[model samples]
Target: MEQASEMGEIGREARHEGGKDEEFRVQPKWRKFLAHVGPGALVAIGFLDPSNLETDMQAGADYKYQLLWVILVGMVFALLIQTLAANLGVKTGKHLAELCREEYPRFVNICLWIIAELAVISDDIPEVLGTAFAFNILLKIPVWAGVILTVFSTLLLLGVQRFGARKLEFIIAAFMFTMAACFFGELSYLRPSAGEVVKGMFVPRLQGKGAAANAIALFGAIITPYNLFLHSALVLSRKTPRSVKSIRAACRYFLIECSLAFVVAFLINVAVVVVAGSICNAGNLSPDDANTCSDLTLQSTPLLLRNVLGRSSSVVYAVALLASGQSTTISCTFAGQVIMQGFLDMRMKNWVRNLITRVIAIAPSLIVSVVSGPSGAGKLIIFSSMVLSFELPFALIPLLKFCNSSKKVGPLKESIYTVVIAWMLSFALIVVNTYFLVWTYVDWLVHNHLPKYANALVSIVVFALMAAYLVFVVYLTFRRDAVATYVPVSERAQAQAEDGTGAQAVAAAAAADHPAPFRKDLADASM
Candidate 1:
C-alpha cells in the first residue's frame, strides 16, 4: 500500500514538473482539422529541398521523366510510415527516438545518436545553403553571410516558441504556400506536355549513367530518415485527449492530412522534374541550361524558373527555397532534441541543441565550401545521406521490432498487412543501400592509383568493416524484442498519478549523462 502511494506521487510529479508540456490543444472542431494538416506540410518541405530538387532535375533531364513514378510509390510508403510514427507518439505518449533510447541496448543507442546526429547535420547543410542561396538571389546577400543570417533568424524564431507551437506552424504554413506558389508558377509557365506528365507519373524507367543513383536520390529525399523522427515527435506537440478512441481519431486525421500533404509534395516534385526537363531538354537549348541540367543548385533553380516561366518566377522560386530551408531547420532542431532527450532523457535549451547541430554541419560545410566551392558542399549532402542510409538499420530495425511486439505498442497497433509491407520496404531499402555501397567501393578500388598490394589490403579492411555492419543490421532484423508491455489507459492514469515523488531525481539523473553516448542503439533481442 505504501509503495503504491509512492508510485502514485511519482506519476503526478512527472506529469507536472519541468517545461515538459501536455500534448497540443486545438480550439474548435475546425481547428483540429486544420492542425491535423500541419505536419505533412513541414514534411513535404523537407523533401522539396535543393538536394531533392537536383535529384528530380537529374532524373527528368537524363531519363526524361521516366522515373516520376517513384514519387507516387514513395509517397504511399511515406504515408504508411509517417502514420506509424504519429501512432507511436499517440499510443505510447512518447516520441520514436525516446522509445528507441528506452528499448535499445546502450552501445546501440550511442551509435544511433552519432548516426542520427550526422543525418541532421547533413540534412541541415542543404537547408543552410538553400536559404543562403535564396537570400543571395532575392536580396543580394552573399552565401556565407546568408548562411549565418539563416542560422541567426531561425534561432531567434525558435526562441519565441514561448508564443506557441501553433504560431510556429503558421510561419511554416506560409512557407508551404510560398513553395507551392513558386512551383505552380514555374509549372504554368513551362507548360510542359500534360499527357506526358501523367504518363511519367505512372511509368517507371531509367537509363544512362547514374540514373539509378538519381532514382535513389529521389526516394531518399522523399522518405528521409530524419523526417520519420520529426513526424513522430511533431504529433506529440498536439494535445490529443489521453483516450484510446481520441488518440485513434487523431491518428486517422493525421494520416489523411499527411496523405494530402504528400500528394501536394508529390505534385511539386513532379513540377520540379518537368520544369527542369523542359528547360534542360531544350533542343535549341542555351549553353547555361544544358550545363546546369547536369548539376542544378539552388542558384540555378531560380534562374531556370525565370527562363522557363516569367520574370516573377525567380522571386517565387527564391521564396520557396527560403521556406524550404527554414522549415527544414525548424524540423531538424526538433528531431535533434528528440534524439537527445529520447536516448538520454536530457533536456537542453533549444538553442543549445540547434547550435550543436549547426556547428557540426557548418564546420565541414565551411571547409568544403572554402576548398572546393558548392560542389564540395553538395557532395557532403550526398555523403550524409549515404551515412543516413548506413544508420537507417539501427533506427528502423528497432522500430519494426517495437511496433510488432506486444510489449511496447501492444497487439492492437499495426495490422499484419502493414507489418509485412513495412518489412518488404525495409528489405528493399537495405538491399539498395548496401548494393550501392559495395558498388562504390569496388569502383573506388578499380580507379584508385595505389599499389596493388596496398589497394588489396585497403579493400579487404573496408570489406570486413562493411560485412560486420551488415551482419549487425541483419541480426537486428531477424531478432525478436521484448515489447514494453503497455498498460491499459486506466492503469496508465494510475501509474502516472502514482509516479510523482522522484520526478526531479528521475529527470535530473537522466539529464546528467547520456545513457548511450557511444553505444550502437541495438535493442535487446529478448526484451
Candidate 2:
C-alpha cells in the first residue's frame, strides 16, 4: 500500500511538470509581446525629447523636407545600437556600466563614468527647459519659476515607483501616444506634400544654411548616449527566461517592440517636420508668421501652429511638450540611477538619486531661465543638444567594443555581419560629428568680431580640446577588452561541485559580500 501511494505521487508530479511546459509553449504571442513592451517604450522617450522636437521644427521650417533623410538614418542606427545593448544585458546578466567597471582599469573607468554622467546632465538640461517652457505656456508662470517647479514635479513622477516600474512606463507611453496623436492630427490638417515627405525620407540632400548643423543635431537628439545605458539596464527589470530558445524568443519580442516604438517615434518626428514645413512655408503667411518661421524657437512654434490648427492648438502643443519633458525626465532619472550604481558599485535610494540629478540639472537651467528669460532658455536647449552630439562617440565606441568582444559575451557575441555593420555605423557617426564640431568652432572663430589676441587665445584653447577629444576617441577604439576571457577548468569544477551541493555555499558567499539587507533591498527595488 505504501509503494502504491509513492507511485501515485510520482505520476501527479510528472503531470504537473508536463503541464507547466505545455503552458509555457502555448502562451499567446500577444501576451509575450506585451511583457517585453516597457523597456522599448522607455528608451523611445529619448528619441522624442524636447531637443528632438526643437531640431525637427527647425529642420522643417528651414529646409522643408531636405533633412528628413537624416532622421531616417538616425532611427536606423538607433535601432541597431539599442538591440545590441538589450542583447548584452540579457546574455551576460550585467548592464553596460557594470561590465565597464569589471573590464577597464580604475582610472579609465572613472573617466568613462564622468563622461557618462556629463552626458546625463547634458541630456537633462533640455528636458528641464522643456518642462519649464510647458509651465510658462500652461500656467502663466515665469520660466525660472517653471524650472524650480520641474524639480518637484520630477520627484513626484519618480514617486510612481511605489506603484511599480510598469506604472511609470505606462504613464510615459500614454504621453507618447498623446503627443503622436496631436502631431498626426496637425499633419492631417496641414496636408504637407506626401511626395515631398517621401522624397525627403529617401533622397539624401542637405541644402541651404544651417542644414548640416541641424542634421547633426537631429542625429544627436535621436540616438542618445544615455539611452543606451538605460536600455541595457531596463531589460534587467524583466524576468526573461534562461533557456536558449526562450532567450531567443525574448530577444525577438524585444526587437519587435523596440522597432514598433521607434517607428511611432519616427513618424511623430516626421509629422513635426511636415507640419512645420507645410504651415510655415505656405504662400499666405503674414509677415509676422514668416519672420517667426525664419527664427523658429519653441515659443514661436506654437504660434506657427496656431495659424493652421486655430489659436487653441497652442495649448495642445504645450500639453504635448509637458508630456515629452515629464516622460523623458523620468527615463533620464532611471538612467542616472543605473549609471551611478553600475559604475560605482554603490547604491542609493531612488528618491535620493533623483533629487541629486535634479539639483545638478536644475542649477544651470534655473540660472539660464532667470538671466536670459524664455528665449535664452530656448537657445540653451539647442546648445545642450549640441553637447549631446559631441558626447555620442564617447559612449558609442565603448558600446560597439563590448558588444563585439567574443571574450566578453562568449557564445552570445554578435555575428560578424552585425559587428562589421555596427562598426561602420560607429565610424560614420564619429566622422560626421567630428567634422561638425570642427567646422562649427571654426565658423564661429571666423564670424565672431572679437579682438585678434582674445580670439587667438580662445581658438587655441578650443582646438586643444578638440585634439584631446580625438585622442580619447582613438584610445577607446583600440582599448583592450580586459574582462575575464575564460574561467579556469578547476574553478568550473568547483562551481559544479557547489551546484551539486545545492548552492548553499554560493548563496553564503553572496550574502557575505552583500551583508546589508537594506542595500540589497535598495538595489532590487531600483532594478
Candidate 3:
C-alpha cells in the first residue's frame, strides 16, 4: 500500500508538470513545422537554377508545350529522393557526405570527393554564366565584365550566412518568389492555351529531331548531384527532438515542405515554357522573332518577351535571371562547404571556400566569355549539364544503398515498397542518363572533322574511360557496408531484456537527461 501511494504521488507530480508544460509548451502544428522549412527551400533552389530555366525555354521555344510532362515526372522523382536524403540525416544525425566517408574505403572516398568537387564546379558554371548574361542585359556590361562582377556579388549575398542559415534561406526563398512572380506575370499576359498545356503535362510524347535530347537535358538539370549532398547536409542544421515520433514528424514536415517547394519550382518552370511557347508560336511573329524562336537562347528571351512586357522587358527578364543565378550560386557555395567538410573532414572559412570554387568555375567562363562571347557561355552550360549527368549515379546510388542499409538508418530503414519504387525509378533515370551520355559522346565522335587515325585514337581513349566508369559504378553498387552507425530500437529492447541491470542503467540515464514528462513516458515504455 505504501509503494502504491509513492507511485501515485510520482504520477501526480508528472501530471502537474505536464499541465504547466502544456500551458507554455504546447505549440500549433504550423509553429512546430516552421522549424523544418529551410532545408527543403534551399534544396529547391537547384530545380530553379539557370540551367533549368534554359532547358525550359528551349523546350517551349523548340517543341511548344510538348515537354511539360518531363518537368512533372522529374519533380516527382526529385521529391522521392530528396525525402530519403532528409530522413537519412534526421535518423542518423549524419549527412550523406559524412556517411560516405565513413562507409567507403580511403581511396574510394578520395575519388568520390574529387568527383563531387568537379560536379560542384560544373554546376556553378551555368550559374556564373547566367548571372553574367543577366548583367549584360541589365547594366549593358560585357559578359566578361559581368562574370567578374558575379564573384563579388555572390560573396556579398553569402554574407547572410553569418547571421544564420534561416536568414539565408529566407533571402533565397524571397528571390525564388521574385523569379516566380516575374514568370507568372509573363504567363498571365501570354496565356498559352490551357488545353494544350494540360495535354502536354499528361501525355508523354517526343516528336522532333532534338526532342529526346531536350527531354534528357531537362531530367539531368533537375536531378542534380550536389543537391543530394546539399539536402542531406542542410537538414543537419535543424536539431530534431531525439525520439522516434519527433524524428518521423521532422521527416514528414520536411517532405511536405519539400513538396511545396517543388510545386513552386514546377509552376515557375511551366510558366517559363508556356511563356516561351505562346510567344514563339504566335501567328504574328516577325521574321527576326521567328529566327530567334528557331534558336532561342537566354540572351534572346528578353527580345522575345518584348511583345508583352515591352520596353522594360529586358529589365524584368534580367532581374528574374539575376535572382535565379544569385540564389543558386549561394546554395551551391553552401553545398561546397558541406561537401568539403564531409569528404575530407576539412572545414574552411566560407569566403575562402566560396572564393576557391568561384575562381575554378570562373576561369573557364571568363575565358569563354572573352574569346567566344555569349554563344560560348551558352555552350559551357551544356557542358556542365553533361558533367552532372555523369556524376548523378555516384551520389544517387550511394544514397539508395545507405538508406536501405539497417546499419545506416537502423529502425528507420525505408519500407520495401519505397525501396522497390525508388530503385526502379532510379534505374530508369540512370538508363536515360546513360543513353544521353553515350549519344553525346558518339555524336561528338562522328561529327569531329578529324583524320581516321585521330578519330580512332580519340574513340579508344574515350571508350576506355567509359569502361572504367562503368566498373566504378558497379563496384559502388555491389560493395557491402560494414559500419553500423545507428542501433535499432528492437535490438536495444532485446539487449535490455537480456540484461535487466543494463536496462535499468539506461532508463536512469535517459531519465536524468530527459524532462519529467519524458521520463515518465520512458519509464512506462520500459515497463
Candidate 4:
C-alpha cells in the first residue's frame, strides 16, 4: 500500500511537470509551424541557389517558356526524396552519412564519403562564384576580389551559427523572402502571358537547339544530391518525441513545412524564368538590349532588367542575387560539416570546416574570374551544375537502397508505392544524365578539329570512365544492406536490461555487440 502511494505521487509529479512544459510551448497554428520551419527552409535554399538562377535565366531567355515543366517535375521528385531523408533521420536517430558508415564496409564507406564530399564542393562552386558576381555588381568590386571576399564573408556567417541554428535559419528565411519579392515584383511589372507560362509548366517540350541541354540543367539545379544528406541531418536539430504517434506527427509537420517551402521556391523559379522570357521576347528591344538577351548570362541578366525596369531595378537584382548566394553558401558549409563528420567519424569546429571548404571552392572561382573573366565564371557555374548531375546517382542510389531495406529503417521503410515511384524517378534522372553525357561527347567528337588518333584516344578514355560510373551505380543499387537484420532497442529498455542481474545482463551484452539506434538527445544536441 505504501509503495503504491509512492508510485502515485511520482506519477502526479510527472503530470505536473508536463503541464508546466505545455504552458511554455508555442500555442495555435502559426507558432507551431514556425518551430518546425528551419530544416525545410535550408533545403529549399539549395533549389534557389545561384546555379538554379543561371539555368532558369538561360532557359527563359533562350527557349522562352518551353522548360518550365522540368522545374515542376524536378521539384515533385525533390519533395518525395526529401521526405524520405527526413523520415530516415527521425526514425533511426542517424543522418544519412552516419547510416552509410555503419552499413558499408570501410573501403566502400570511404568511396561514398569521397563522392559526397565532391558533391558538396560541386554545389559550393556556383555559390562562391555567384556571391562574387553579386559583390562585383553591387559594390563595383572586381570578380577576383569578390571571390576572396566571399571566403571571409562565409566564415562570418558560420560564426553567426555559433549562436544557434534557428538564428541562422531566420536570416536565411529573410533572404528567401527578399529574393521572392524582387523576382515576383519584376514578374508583376513586366507581365508575361499567363497562358504561355501555364502552358510551359504543363506542356512538355524540348524542341529548340539547346532546349534539351537546358532541360537537363534545370533538373540538376532543382534536384541536388547533397540536399538529401543536408535535409536528413538538419531534421536532427528539432526535438521530436520518440513515440510512434509523435514520430508520425513530426513527419507530417515536416512534410507540410517542406511542401510550403518548395512551393515558394517553385514560384520564385517560375518568376525568374518569366521575367527573363518576357523581356527577351518583347519584340521592341534596342540593339544593346538584344545583344544582352543573346548572351543572357547572370552578369547581363540584371542589365536586361535595367533596360526594361530602369537602372534602379539593377539594385533589386543585385540584392536578390546577394541573398541567394549568401544563404546557399551558409547551407553548403553546414552540409560539408555534416558530410565530413558523418562519413569519417571525425568532427571539427564549424568555422574550421567552413574555412577549409571555402578555400578549396574559392581557388577555382578566383582563377576563372581573373583569367577568363565574368563570362568564364558564368560558364563555370554551368559546368559545376553538370558535375552535380553526374554525381547525383552515386548519392541517390544508396539513399534509395537504404530507405527501402527493412533492416536499415525497420518498420520505417518506405511503402512499396513510394519505393516504386522513387526508383522510377531515379531511373529517369539516370537516363537523362546519361543522354546528356553521350550527346555532348558525340557532338564534340563530330565538331572538334583534333586529329583522328587523338580523338580516338580521348573517346576511349571517356567511354572507360562512363563504364566505370555505370558499374559503380549498379553496385550501389544491388548491394545488400549490412544491417538488414538489426533491431533497435529503446533507451529505457536497454538501460533496464543492462542493469538487471546475470542472464539479462548477458543478453544485453550480446545485443550491444550489434549496431544500435543512436540516442535521440545526443543526436539532437550535436547539431
Question: Which of 2 and 3 is the better model by TM-score?
Answer: 3
Q: Clashing pairs in model 2?
A: none
Backbone clash total, candidate 4: 0
**Consecutive 10-residue window with the lowest summed lDDT within model 2:** 512-521
Residue lDDT tens for model 4, 1-527: 99888766654543342332233233665665665676886788778888999988888888898889998998999899999998887777788888888888888889888888888887888888888888888899898898999987887776776678566656666765776676777777787888999999999999978787788778878877888888888887766533344456567888999999899889889888888888888898889888878777777767545544477766766767777787777777668778888889887776788778878888888899999998888878877887887788877887888887778767767789998999998998888888888998999999999999999999999999989888888888888886764365455433433333233333333332322233443344322
Please, what is the whole-model Cα lDDT of each candidate in the order they appear?
A: 0.68, 0.76, 0.78, 0.77
Candidate 1 Cα misplacement greater than 4 A, ranges: 1-37, 139-150, 160-172, 241-243, 307-309, 489-527
Global local distance difference test of model 3: 0.78
RMSD of model 2, in Å? Answer: 6.9
RMSD of 3: 7.5
Off by over 4 Å in 4: 1-34, 160-172, 304-309, 485-527
Best by lDDT: 3
Model 3, range 80-153, lDDT digits (tens) per residue?
Answer: 99999988878887789999999899999999999999989988998998999999998898999999998898
Pick out the ten consecutive residues of candidate 3 with the lowest summed lDDT. 518-527
For candidate 3, the TM-score is 0.86
Shift of residue 423 alpha carbon in model 4, Å = 0.4
Q: What's the lDDT for residue 492 in model 2?
A: 33
